[model samples]
Target: MQAKIKKVELRNLAFEDYKQLKNSMVESYPEMADSYWRANDIERLLGIFPEGQLVILVDGKVVGSALSLIVAEKLVDKKHNYSQIIGDYSFSTHNPQGEILYGIDVFIHPNYRGLRLGRRLYDARKELCEQLNLKAIVFAGRIPSYGQYSNKLTPTKYIEKVKSKQLHDPVLSFQLSNDFHVLRIMKNYLAGDEDSKEFAVLLEWNNIYFDESPRLINTEKNVIRLGLIQWQMRSLGNLEALFEQSEFFIDVVSGYTCDFAVFPELFIAPLMADYNHLTEAEAIRELAKHSEPIRKRFQELAISYNINIISGSMPYLENGNLYNVGFLCKRDGTSEMYTKIHVTPNEVQHWGMKGGSEIKTFDTDCGKIGIMICYDVEFPEVSRIMADEGMNILFVPFLTDTQNAYIRVKHCAQARAIENECYVAIAGCVGNLPKVNNMDIQYAQTAVFTPSDFAFPSNGIKAEATPNTEMTLIVDVDLRLLKELHEHGSVRILKDRRTDLYQIKKIEN
Candidate 1:
């Protein structure tokens, strides 16, 4: 008869499950004369690391358990025997600062055997290792069937045969099938396990996701150069003309040592010059028609220049509703869009654009970043939420028509930088668009901002272009410095946020 595990639930081991776990262990390993784990031993392991302890439940009852402890890599390198590593199953050497996970014990009830409960427990261990970013999972697995062949074959010879598929040992074979590799065989690893002649196999499962590179140690060495373009507005020409104009900036930025290039909000409004004779609403609809081609060109430009490009905010039509959207085109040929979450009165009243409801931060090789178009940056909550999610930089692309309008965006962006302890980069359209209807006037001074702390520039401005000039401003920001500020800055705004008093929760649509 096949074992049917009905209603199997996997969860963290709680203190209350100790009794059922003990019963399962006793029933699973009946061949042993003494208890595999004492009550105090279980309690000590749980007390030290509750996150590493997980139990499998069926019908609200514990059916299996897997316990693990973190240990230093050097400890595993020096110790060969299981008893020496685990300190006689007491887990006295568990280290919270360890970089490796040491699997102490895994057991399933006899009645629950063949139900793949052991596999589930192992999967949970693998996930825990990933979450902790551990180096690897190392454990001494018993060779239960080795005792029967002890008289005929040596431990090393037995292992070679099992590895070669000539023989099968229950524990080692199961581990091998689960992507574990045998490091070597150990003698007298387990004194009480007579089934394996007290021998064990040293096995390891590496966490491939764990990055051990030493690239991020020096914050100064990790710098991302950005190019901010204060694009000059001109009359709309053919698509070829607009493409050529964009390619010129891409070409110039590619000549420099920069990782990303940014354009301003409504940078493509110049393309709507032909329809400028029409009403404001008609011209916006016409501008939305070029959204797809603009996105494709930006993607191609990103790939051609081998640089990440924030294509800036454009009038985008989706599902018959227009939105102010920014396209993030990565050099790897992937792209994502960020819609303006907050619509201005002028935009809503004149252009029929509605505010977006979703907020997203894009993950890059440098770090996590978020995009907030003009009015969105004015709200403290938007930038605050992004900073809370580990975002190191916030990109704002604006289209202000007056000096006062520009100052509003500038002051709000600077305030966000100071409050969130994050870098803010703003790129905007400069010069006038006489032929274009609602977008005929423009004013901007593209600038990269930093937090107002000792670690950053005194004025909080990393680099800025001359006001209303059609030029690109290049600046290299250090990611390591941003991380350091979060921990040791003059003020810990992100860390010191009073969440107990008031919490900002996202209202999902």
Candidate 2:
């Protein structure tokens, strides 16, 4: 029969449970005679750092425990013995100001071995790391099965075999499965440990959530390079032509090592071969038919070129309702969709499209970013809400048939950057599509806008393509400067907002 763990409770280690903890540790590691910890050591550890020690109880009985201490990165700089690094189990070198959490020991009772209680203990340690914002978790893992192969293979060879799945080590395999990577093999880590042959593997679990990139306001490392394409309309030859044009720009941007590439709204209009014969509304419905293929091609291009592509906006028909949607394709072949939240009267009247209410900010390798389509940037509240959610960049893809319409998007984009203290990149469609009904004429100028501050350009324009031209404009915007402007600029608009007077609450359905 299997033992069922009923009512498992986890809390900080208390003084009364010292003897039970020692007994559990001794029973768990019966092969090692010196495995039991002294009462005075436990008392001293608890007194120094009470939060680092945790105890597990099953039915009011001590069944498991985890001990940890904080250490600076310099302590584990090079390959060294565990006893030397840990100061002979005294942990006298523990630093409260350290950025790493060093795991000393974790064990569970024999009766609770199959209950997955060890995984729970690890989960608790990870939670504590997040709460403390630690850089990573490090420990020396034992390879219990290496003792049998010690005569035939070296410690490094044994580790290589275990990593390649050619050999199975109970402890090392468990740690590897839990997202821990072995840094190196340490010799004589334990003096008399027969199971490991006195050797151990140094393992580390880096916190993926930690941001280690430089935060200098004017440094090149702080910039997010953008490639904006001002697409020119010509002929709707076929779907192949549409794909060829998109691949051309993506290749160009990737060659220049741009972080993200942006394209204009309805750039896929060339796929609608029968646009001249179909009505305005019918053409939009027809364009929606190629949404899946368009999305797939963008994802393939993003992965092949190793670049991020904003697929602009497309006419999408879902459940008998039409919407203008944009797809952000990451280099990893993953994607996120943003629907037009504020549909213009022209879109509703001409294309039979409805407005979307969902707004979101995407977290990327560069930074937090948001996507708004064309006219959506005209609304200050939309960008403000995104900025409040920690978005440092906004991408606006637009399609305007007249100069006045193009000016609306450009001016509003600049205003959004200034008002929100964020960077905005706008890409638009240009030239003429004489055969297409609704897309016959276009006027655009692709540009990257920045906040009007001392750290940015005086005109607030980082880079801009010539008006009515078909070209790709590439620019770099520093996100660190945006952070500085919000905190310590000439005019702190975002921080000086009069929130006590009015508030904008999002209504959830």
Candidate 3:
């Protein structure tokens, strides 16, 4: 029966119900029309069949109840006349059906209606069913009582759907509200009770989510030509002697007409150094003024040959420390300097040089470019971070001695390019310096490399210049062709790498 709309409390009976329970239930529902419990009956039930008392309260009053009982009778009756036969089942070691909880009666006081109080009562009974871990909760009720209260139906027709192992009515409604479809129905009933019309239904949750990593197209086929030249004096002691050599190398690069040119670790010489062979501060100042003339020489070379030149690095002694820097000079003489961010242990330990911390990518007449110095390129992330920032070309200038260690160091530069899908141009020391103890040692086999192979095809050299050899390697790169190969190429290695699973931070960031 329907009642007034009001808030109600839903809870299990935990206390004695005497006077108020008698007035609200016993006296009020004498005809078994409202509720069956007097207040004390609640306590007694809790004391005896404690598991059966599942109830709800409305403003501290019991408005609903779900109880259970056991009947000692034969499994089959007249109702089983047309019933289907099934296998034997029992409880304990002898029963395959195990124990069962029978939901006996569920009632709501007529005073408390319209609140869907009956459903809450049903849910409480279901909870008891689960707590007892019964194979199933079985109940018998009139189809009229149940069907008339369909929306509020206990042991609903959906119970048939559930019994037949079909979708749950309420759960299916919940599913449809959230976009889902029912698969099938399953039926399970008391073998002898087939004619009795007592049964259940089963349900399943739907599959709806996924996990995938994003994919990039092409992801390879990039080419870059990098040249590293150290301008001015070789090392510190012979600052005055290498001016001629520097001019000769500059002319060689100008004549070579390469796509890109890079000068060594400290390209501008004493131009960036605050001191000139222990000269006075005023003399050092005069030396700093010559940087413009030298830069102009590099600029003219770039313009005349139509090449992109990274005027290697210079110590821009701004503020207090010397900044390891490089300049990307276009053919138009417009130049942007990329300061080296990662300084070596020696720089911090001995030189008073500080590491730069900025990451950047810039657009150029040739393409998008990023810059790093000798020590900076050792870390893959330096290049990875630049690639992530959308750089297509990486210019790196290094200073090293002649040794196998050089090849190992050079491999990293190639890896940075191949893995990040960009062109890596590394300009390193190709000459000897007389001052610093090992400065004159020719360190590496300098070259440019790509993902599939070295920068140059197998038919040609990857433009390796000699140690102490002043020359330029000119390689014409078809930027569009490289991009095309990256997109629709046969073997796309760069795009296949799963970066999320890799530990980039673990690699000495």
Q: Tell me the TM-score of each prediction against the true structure.
A: 0.61, 0.59, 0.47
* lDDT for 46 (candidate 2): 91
Query: Backbone clashes in each candidate structure, one number apiece?
Result: 0, 0, 29
Task: Mark the regions of model 2 whose C-alpha exceeds 4 Å error after superposition.
Answer: 1-221
> Model 3, 453-497: lDDT tens per residue?
433365223455565454454544545444544543454445555
Model 1 score (lDDT): 0.86
Alpha-carbon RMSD to native, per candidate: 18.6, 19.6, 25.1
Deviation (Å) of 14 in candidate 3: 92
lDDT (Cα, tens digit) per residue for candidate 2, span 262-357: 999988886765765788899889889888888899999999998899999899989999999989999888998889998888888889899988
Which run of 10 residues does model 2 get worst, by summed lDDT? 212-221
Every candidate's lDDT: 0.86, 0.86, 0.53
Error of 2 at 77 (Å): 29
lDDT of 1 at 434: 77
- What shift in Å separates residue 64 of candidate 1 from its native position after superposition? 50
Q: Give residue 367's lDDT in candidate 2 (0 to 100).
A: 77
Give the TM-score comparing model 2 with the true structure, all chains together. 0.59
The residue ranges of model 1 lying beyond 4 angstroms of the native Cα positions read: 1-221
Total residue pair clashes for candidate 1: 0
